[model samples]
Structure formats: structure tokens, C-alpha cells
Target: MSVATLHYIHDPLCGWCYAAQPLVSAMQAQLGDRLALRLHGGGLFGEPRRVDAALAQHIVHSDERIAQLSGQPFGEAYKQGLLADEGTVLYSLPPIAAVLAAESLDAAKAYPMLAAIQNAHYQRGLRVVEPQVLTELAEEIGLDGTHFAQALARADGHTLFEHVQASRRLLDEAGGHGFPTLLLEVDGRRTLLPHHHYYGRPDAFVQMLAGQLPAVH
Candidate 1:
């Protein structure tokens, strides 16, 4: 049997990534240890940037479309609070570092940490760029807050920068043009899988990948 790895290229603040959370969950449940699921943060907002009115409008419009197509909820708090706030920042590095920190402590906690961060931004209207917020999210997912914070601190400087760069390289190598790209690697060869059609339908996503997966025995 050949080794299989699924690379998920995404950004913490990307609305489509939030929408694809369910598909990720389905993949985990169905594939289990037979396939290695790796997350790559694409650093959509590598530099710290505040959300301007125009950007907020664009994000709201894009989020609405994502919710409509993927059936993911954009909470009232997000819509009425975050988007409406003029002082909101859209930095991705802090949240990405938080995910990396969780992965360092426990590989299984990585995805859950990402999910929690996404929920913090898209559902709870929390400031994911804040260190306290990221730490709190980690604790919510069962990680010891102090350890998580320390791990986050360790990943803060050069480590997080390197990870983001690596993820971007993977995106380029995989021929992915945007966030939420799924690249499946069997043995050594790689193929980019379709993600749009599978939105709001994780069962279909699993079924499609089922064919590409090699027999276990």
C-alpha cells in the first residue's frame, strides 16, 4: 500500500476556509490514519493590516456568498460587530502561529485549534490577532493555557515566518491559486483535487477522494 497525504492550503481569515471546515471534519472521520492530513497556512494576510470600510464591505459580500453556497453561518456578532467595527485588524500571522503552537504540543489539536480560531473570528466576533484571544481559544480546545502560550511565544519570531513561507511554497508547487485548495499526494506524485463542487457536501467530497485512495490491503 502506498502512503497518502492530503495537503490543505488555507488562511485563518479566509471565509472559504471557514466554510470548508465541515469537509475537513468528514475527511478526518472517513480517512482516519489511512491518510495524513496536513494543514498549510497560506498567509493570506502576512502583513498586519487593519480593515478599512471598503475592505469590510468586500469581506461582508464575500462571506455572504460563502455562507449561501456552503451553508456555513456568519453569526450576527461577526456581521454586526466585527465587520461593522472600524478598528478591526485582519492580521493572519498571530492565528497561524497559534495553530502551529497547538500542532507542536499535539498534532491532533492542530485542526481543532484552527477551527476554534475561525469560529472566534467568524462566529464570536473576537480579535484573533490578539495574543490573549488566541491563547483563550487554545484553552477552549483543551490545551493547557500556559503551555500553549509558551509554545506560541516560541513560534512567534522566526519559526512562524518560516512556516508561512513553506506553506506558500507548497501552494505554488501544488499549483493552487487560492485558499482552501486540496492537494492529494499518493506515494510521491501529487494531484490537486476539486474543492468547490464539494462545498456543503462532505459526503460527496469523501466519495470522490475514495476513488483516488489506494487499497489499504
Candidate 2:
């Protein structure tokens, strides 16, 4: 039997994407060798701009809603510490490009590195815009901090742009109109898993995938 591929289309800096991380991780753990996971960068912000006050409140409220609905933890620090810092730029491209750089260095480390960045930004309230924070994360995950930094500094601008473009194309093709979408391929066919809203229990999502998949070696 051919190995199944699960493509996770998401933006690294998206709050809802952060909420979905635990479930994705759980799915990955369960599938293991039976599946291959791929990350597609969904650029939520193509252009940099200051987050408006209303927009910030909306984001925080959405996070709260997800936590309440899915039972995911959304601590006060996530909003107060991370989003409250005015100096921190809310650019999604840098971190997305950074993950691509990490993937180029080591594919296995890409997802974990991305998850770490999200945890730092959303959970731990670390400033992702700061080079020092990213560097520290790179080192923590046993990646070459210098190379990671260099790659991020000189990331293929056009390539990253193209990646976002491609992801948008794929999203359109899949009829997906949201962030944190999951596209699964099995037996040469693609299916978009329905995730109407955020989910709190990662295990439930994992079980959903396991149930959908045929029992085969």
C-alpha cells in the first residue's frame, strides 16, 4: 500500500493555527510511518501593517471563542504579553519563510520548529520579531542557529512569495476558504477535512483521521 500524505495548510502566526497545533501533533504521532506530513505555508498577511485596535480585539476574542468551544487553553498572557507589545511587528511572512529555511536544512525539524515559534508567540508570549528569540528557538531544537539566521536573513524572497501564491492556488483548488485547513490525500484522491471551527482536544482530531484511514500496513 502507498503511504498517505497529509498536507497541513496554515499560517505560522495565525492564532487559530496555534490552537490547532496540538491536534496536528497528535495526528502525526499516531500516523507515524503510515503517513507523511507536509507543511504548506498559507500567507495570512502578504503585506505588513499595524494591527488595528478593533482587529486586535477581534483576534483575542476569536482566540477566546476557540478556547471555549474546543477546550483549548488560551491564557491571559497570550493576549497581554504577545499581542500587547506594540514594538513587535505582526508579519507572518518572516516566520513562514523561516520554517521553509528550516525545512531546507532538515525536513523532520520543520514542523516542530514551526510549532515552537507558535508556542513562543502565542503560549509563552515571546516576541517572534526579535532575531534573538528565533535564534534561541533554533538552538533549542538542535538546529544550526547561525545557518538558520542566515537563511532567514537572505530567504528567497521570490521563492517565499511564490510559495504563498502556490498555497493560495491550492486553497482555491480545494475550495478551502479558511486558515488551518487540512488536505488529506489517499489513493490518488484529495479530500478536505471539515473543521468548521477550532478543536480543543487533539486526540479527537487524531481519532477522526485514524477512523477515516483504512487499516493497512
Candidate 3:
């Protein structure tokens, strides 16, 4: 059987990526070990930036649309707390590095780490850019404290920069249009899947992927 790889291009800070979590989970359950799920952090907020009142309001409006379409919850902590906090810095690399750190220690935990980071950000209004926060999230996801600390320390530096660069290159090669781009690769050919069509309908998403899997002979 030919290997089928699904490349997910996303950023932790992206509300849409969080909205796509259900679809990702459905794909995981449907494909199991039959397919490989690869996550790429495209670094939407690669630089350290602050969200002003106006920008925060804009984000809230966008988030409401996402919640309406995808059925993903946006906690009050996020809408009222994090967004309202003027001094809070937004950067994607730190959380992306946390994911890389988890992946380095255990591949299975990578997605879980990403999920946890999203939860902490959207649900709990935590400052994910802080190393301490990232470490706590890692431990919460069952990763060993000592090893994860070392891995995160290493990843927070040049490793994360290199990974983001490579991820962006992949996006450019795929002709992707921003975060949450899903590319299905069967054999050596890659086809970009129209994932937005099934935002809240994960079953439909899995069925579509199932129809394509037979070609991987």
C-alpha cells in the first residue's frame, strides 16, 4: 500500500485552526495508522506584536463567525480577558516551538500539545508565549517534565526559526492561501483539499478522505 500523508499548515494563534480541530480529530479517527498527519506551523504571528483595542475588536468579530460556522467555543476569558489585555504580546513561534518540543520527545503528543496550547489560549486566556506557561501546558498533557523542559529550551531558539522557515517553504510550494491549509499527498503527488467546505461537518470530511484513500495503492 502506498503511504498517504496529510499536511496541515496552521498556526497556534490562528482562531480558524482551533475551529478546525474537530475536523482534524475526525480525520485522525477515520484514518488511524493508515495515513500520516503532519503539522506545519506557518507562523501567522511570527513576530512579537501587541493587539490594540481596535484589532482585538476585529478579532472578536472574526472569532464569532468562526464559532458560528465551526461550532468551536470562544470562552469569555478569551473574548473579554486576553483580547482586552492591552499589554499582552502575541507571537506564534513560542507556542510552535512548544509543539516542536513535544514532538521531539513524543510524536504522538505533538497534536495534544498543540490542542493544549489552543485550549490554554482560547479557553483559559493564558499567555502561551511565556516559557513557564508552555512548560505547564506540556506537563498537563502528560509529557515528562524534565525532558520536555530541555526540549522546549532548545526549540525556543534556532530550531523553531528553522522549522517555521521550512513550513513557509512548504506553504509556498503548495500555493497555499494562509493558515489551515490541508494538502493530501498520495504516492508522490499532492492535492490540496478544500477543507473549509466541511468545517462543522467532520463526518463529511472523513468520507471525502475515505474516497481518496483507495487510490493510494
Q: Could you report the Cα RMSD, in angstroms, for every candidate shown? A: 1.3, 2.0, 1.5
Instruction: Please report, in order, the local distance difference test score of every candidate based on alpha carbons.
Output: 0.90, 0.78, 0.90
Residue-by-residue lDDT tens digits, candidate 2, 46-122: 77756667768878888887777666665567688656755556777877887887887888888988998887887
Model 2 lDDT vs. the true structure? Answer: 0.78
Once superposed on the true structure, which residue ranges of model 3 sit more than 4 Å away at CA? 215-217
What lDDT tens digits, residue by residue, belong to model 1 across residues 1-217? 2269889999999999998998988988888667788989989998988888899989989998998889988888989998898898899999999999999999999999999999989999999999999999999999999999999999898998889899999998888888988999887888999888889999999888888989877
Pairs in clash, predicted candidate 1 = none
RMSD of 3: 1.5
lDDT of 3 by residue, 1-217 (tens): 3268889999999999998999888988778577788999989997998999888988989899999999998888887899999988999999999999999999989988999999899989999999889999999999988889899989877788888999999999999888899999887889999999999999999989888885544
Candidate 3 lDDT at 152 equals 90
Number of the candidate with higher TM-score, 1 or 2: 1
Cα displacement (Å) at residue 83, model 1: 0.9
